[model samples]
Target: MNTHNLIVGISGASGALYGIRLLEACRDLGVQTHLVISKAGEMTLHHETGLAVSDVRALATKSYKIADIGAAIASGSFRNAGMVIAPCSIRSMSEIATGVTSNLMTRAADVALKERRRLVLMVRESPLHSGHLATMKTLSDLGAIIAPPVPAFYTHPTSLDDMVNHTVGRTLDLLAIENNLAERWDGLKNARTRSQENDGGRD
Candidate 1:
């Protein structure tokens, strides 16, 4: 498979591990990643993951400061496959939706949409107000995929890591990247196997 370059932004939202694991999955798939972390992201990184900014930057192929709008990633000509904002805050999402990027993180996302490239927002808010939902609709209309980091219980995830990996894997699928980070849904694979075995008994 051809190598894909993806831009990842970690906003100030909780569930910062989702962002960290995304970088790790990109490493496993050999997907070159350009990562940007906001000021709130930096704080949440320490608050939630207990990891320093340097440690998180170590996971990406390239890292950009939230203030650096002049970075290559802030332009459409950079030609990345897509951009994902893991645990995207409502403020960042609103910024992207409104085309008013006050920082490099949302600027990159705006570039992706303007370039007709994939832009996935892992919006990490709940009990969203009408304003939030409207912004999401505006983004969706603009071809940005709004994804929340909700776990899939049907996969029978045995641990938090399992849930995280599976959710991230599924999210990356939107970018058309190959990943075996979690078990895929095969329309009840085990149940189908059991049914076939039971039928074979009649033979």
Candidate 2:
């Protein structure tokens, strides 16, 4: 497997920053990223980040059109580390779960599953219904990871960037890509010790 190559898919989900930051992180880590963004994802990117689709595409090592089902990344033999659907929309999640891919983004994801490669779906939905939960379970049973982009408060994130970085860092960890984007958790004792040390001079 080509561990340096990763497939990044952006669906029509609200947290476009996750996908963008993932791309940037991969770039910094020297990982070659093959990116595909859905039409709806493009709109969400502009609406949420004011970044044109082209700007986001520039961050990736390579970019593909959502309709290009014949793209290299869509093939099982593409030999990438795996695929990640950042901010995966419920629609795309359901499509992949059903094995009825309608576009290159979903198609590449299906390829990853069939190839028995790591497939991470950052499903971004609120108040998921039973049907959605069942769909996620189905994907999990098939060896696909349903990693929603939930933030970790243990990192004491002070900004949106910190939260996003933490999520992206964990996602990268799933692919065995080592990175310092996430703040490692120390033991409770260490945490308390730090707190006490800081309090010694305060009061």
Query: Would you list the C-alpha lDDT of every candidate in the order shown?
Result: 0.91, 0.92
- Backbone clash pairs for candidate 1 read none
Q: Give the alpha carbon lDDT tens digit for every residue of 33-140 in model 2.
A: 999999999999999999989999999999999999988998887988999999899999999999999999999999999999999999999999999999999999
Candidate 2 backbone collisions, by pair: none
Q: How far out, in Å, is residue 39 in model 1?
A: 0.2
**Tens-place lDDT digits, model 1, residues 1-203:** 32978999999999899999999999888999999999999999999988988999999999999899999998888978899999899999999999999999999999999999999999999889999999999999999999899998876677999999998998888999988876766788685665568679443
Model 1's C-alpha root-mean-square deviation from the true structure amounts to 3.6
Among all windows of ten consecutive residues in candidate 2, which has the lowest summed lDDT? Answer: 194-203
List candidate 1 segments past 4 Å from native.
Answer: 189-203
The TM-score leader among the candidates is: 2
Measured by TM-score, how close is model 1 to the native structure? 0.92
C-alpha TM-scores of all predictions = 0.92, 0.95
